[model samples]
Target: MKEIDKIALIEIKNRQILHVRSKGKLKFYLPGGKREASETDEQTLTRELHEELSININTNTIKYLGTFKAPADGKADGVLVKITCYTAEYTGNLKPANEIEELRWLNNSNLDIISEASKKIFEFLKQKGEID
Candidate 1:
């Protein structure tokens, strides 16, 4: 099995979680990406969000959520993705940048357009009553 490690920021509001659609992609994903060499999870989150969503993460507010794993979307069935999630305070308007084509606020009902790992996240949030 292949394991793809990544970090994600979970920003939910009004029953929706912030997501993004990258250029040339059909699914939406949480606002984060793979960690670079020798980078901490916090540093990865800080850089990815800024590059993709133009936001400044408030390092002081960073809180670890949980890690989720599922079949990697669009990859072979044996390929898996592990997403380490966090919640943090941020500033600046959310905008698509780099490869991101658009921003979306998604709920469980929108699972069809999300990655498998993201589906797990939706179910988790629903169980916690964080998203409807």
Candidate 2:
């Protein structure tokens, strides 16, 4: 089994989660990416957020949300993605940047359009009373 280690930002507002779709992708996902060598979770998420969303994640406000594992989207069977998620305050207008093509705020009702890992996240958030 192959596991992809990724860090993600969980930005929820008014019961909606901020999700992004990369260029040519069909599924929306949490904003983040794989951890670079020698980078901590905070550093990884901060850099990824800046690159993908044109925002600066305030490290001081970073809080661990949870880790989710699911079949890696667009990958072969037996491959899994382990997303380590964090909620943090950020500065700057959220816009698609880098490889991101669009951004959307999503809730549980939109489950059919998100990645499997993201579905797990939405469920977790719902169970915690953080979203509908």
Candidate 3:
């Protein structure tokens, strides 16, 4: 089984979580991407946000949420995505940049539109009373 490592930022506000839909994709996901060579989780998340959303993440405010693993999106069953999640403060207006096609705020009701990994994250947040 191949393991893919990625970072995700769990941006929440007013009981809603931020999610983005990639171009040509049906699922929405938390804003983030794969780690670059020798880069730390924080670095990867920062770079991904800048590239995908044109925003700067505040590193100091980043808080580790938890890690989750699930079948990689659109990949073989044995392929899995090992995601490290964090919550952080960001600068700049949220907009769809780069390959992102749409940006939306999701609550519990929007779980079906996201990936399996993200659905797990949403459940975790809901259990902690972080999202409505």
Best by lDDT: 2
Candidate 1 TM-score over all chains jointly:
0.98
Q: Which tens-of-lDDT digit does each residue in 1-132 have in candidate 3?
A: 899999999888899989999999999988999998999999999999999999999999999989999888899879999989998998999889999999999988887799888888888998999987
lDDT of 1 by residue, 1-132 (tens): 799999999999898999999999999999899999999999999999999999999999999999999998889879999999999999999999999999999888898999989999999998999999
lDDT (C-alpha, whole model) for all candidates: 0.94, 0.95, 0.92
List CA RMSD, all candidates: 0.7, 0.6, 0.9
What value of lDDT does candidate 3 attain over all alpha carbons? 0.92
Candidate achieving the largest TM-score: 2
Candidate ordering by lDDT (highest first): 2, 1, 3
Model 2, position 78: C-alpha lDDT score: 99
Indicate the residue-level lDDT of 47 in model 2: 95
For candidate 2, write residues 1-132 as lDDT tens digits: 999999999999889999999999999999999999999999999999999999998889999999999999999999999999999999999999989999999998899999999999998999999999
- Candidate 3 weakest ten by summed lDDT: 108-117
Clashes of each: 0, 0, 0
